[model samples]
Target: MHSFSTAVLALAASATVVLGHGHIRRVVVAGQTYPGFERWANTDQSNDVTWSFTTDNEGPIEAANVNTADIICHQNAKNAPKSVPVAAGSSLQVVRFNTQGGFEHPGPEMHYLASCGDSGCANVEKTSLRFFKIYEKGLVKGGMADDPDWNMQKWATTEVHKNVQPEGEGFIDTYTVHIPADIKPGNYVLRHEVMGLHRAHLGEAEFYPQCVNLEISGSGSQQPNGVNPMEMYHASDPGVALDIWVDLESYKIPGPAVSSVASKRDIESSPTLKTHARDIKHWLSKFMA
Candidate 1:
């Protein structure tokens, strides 16, 4: 049987990318990386990982790696949930982003702006439900547009939110994002929002807005000149992608032993580490049709 690769799918030429899910357990981990990130928890993505869970209406579960998550948290302990000491009823305010996944984005496309309070302020109304607007390309509005790139442009909800969940140890939020799956490879912001919170005891409502970025990339690529793998899969799988790879150990295409892409070939006839070319035309034809 011909071998194949089962690793995470990449539709770009780059090796790595990120998403902004700011799984911040602490606040200080948001603004920028420095000493503050070292105190409570390590924002270092050395170990912790993320997976995929989505459906047509609820869940289309898949164990795929996703872009990291970013959050708008308080800068005290590096994304820690445990509460810190406050001045009996004092005030603390700051703006920051906590990165959770892997995409290295340029920056947030939108911010949490409050209409009743102005730029960075919020209303202390009786029931603190706030209004928000989505900003894109430099235009501030409430809708989305299709970019020349196939990637998705804005937030799309399949079902209206009937209810909001109460806070757990900290803020508990959820969202439904729609990715075109054909957008240009790199980190792109998928979701952002401004939410209101009211402390009945203190009579203060805090707005915590958050954003999430996405990363789309190709598994690997080679120089010389050929079709972009990502483009081949932009709309349809387009059958098998064509590629040239040098294999020294013809017994197996080099990579992790488990990589299904590993192929067993005869070294004597093919030569070691020779740049051999092949095409996944079989798979491409189906998509083309």
Candidate 2:
């Protein structure tokens, strides 16, 4: 069996040719980073903390499958075995690994949280978990006369890509979401997703959904009810079947509304992209040696 580091190195090497599709490589909470499930590598997930998927490719579920259980996370996703502790009212960064370039699709990004009751999130029935929206960012600005490129720069995906070094040459980018401050402390599943509307006009919008097990710590007392994943979206939803190539006046984010108790924060106006090529090269040298 290949070691974890070897698997990562192999995946990194292959990333140079893959395009469009991506997945969560890791997550950052309270300044500590936790590894995310690499669906394509090291499939012995007995010790994985992130939800598991059946496929090795980093692909998205089609909008046609929005009502299916696959939309709950990804394709044939299984519950994670462990939960990471996170403080309420703190930021959680979902770091993505884009295969060859920046996120090539234009879309909205969202975050949801579902409490796992007392038994915890590791093995809970996914369909029974009710998810309340904690964060949702759609089109920032566009459909104006003077603006060219359809204001793509203001898109949520664009903002995420800003985290990649050299604009479009790097493989890593991040999206930030905040845990609601008033939510009751307990085990919860953090569902982070992005919808690629580049081909939405053809009813082929792409949905990339991922889940993480979180054990929240706080002194709050609120457990808001939420919609089930199966009922959260529809094929004909305005946001799910829109045309971004044309002049769109605005966009309606798909799914349930953001919970009243959800925390809100401003995005960084100027984000710095840190380079990781040198580090990857160093690891490759050792592996080759």
Highest lDDT: give the candidate number.
2
lDDT of each: 0.21, 0.74
Off by over 4 Å in 1: 1-171, 189-191, 197-207, 211-213, 217-289
Candidate 2, residues 110-176, lDDT tens digits: the string is 8898989877788799989999988888776554211112343356776566657432434877888
> Candidate 1 local accuracy as lDDT?
0.21
Model 1: ten consecutive residues of lowest lDDT: 59-68
Residue 69 in candidate 1, Cα distance off native in Å: 19
Give the TM-scores of the predictions, in the order they appear: 0.21, 0.79
Q: What's the distance in Å from true for residue 102, model 2?
A: 3.5
- Ten-residue region with minimum lDDT total, candidate 2: 266-275
Instruction: Give the per-residue lDDT of model 1 (tens digit) for 1-289.
Output: 2123211111121232222223322222223221112223445633211111121211111111111111221211121112222221121122222332211121112222111122111112212212122221111111222211212212111111112233433322233222222223332222232221111112221122232222324332211112211121111111111111111112121111111111122011221223232234655777799
| Residue 33, model 2: Cα distance from true site in angstroms | 1.4
lDDT of 2 at 162: 60
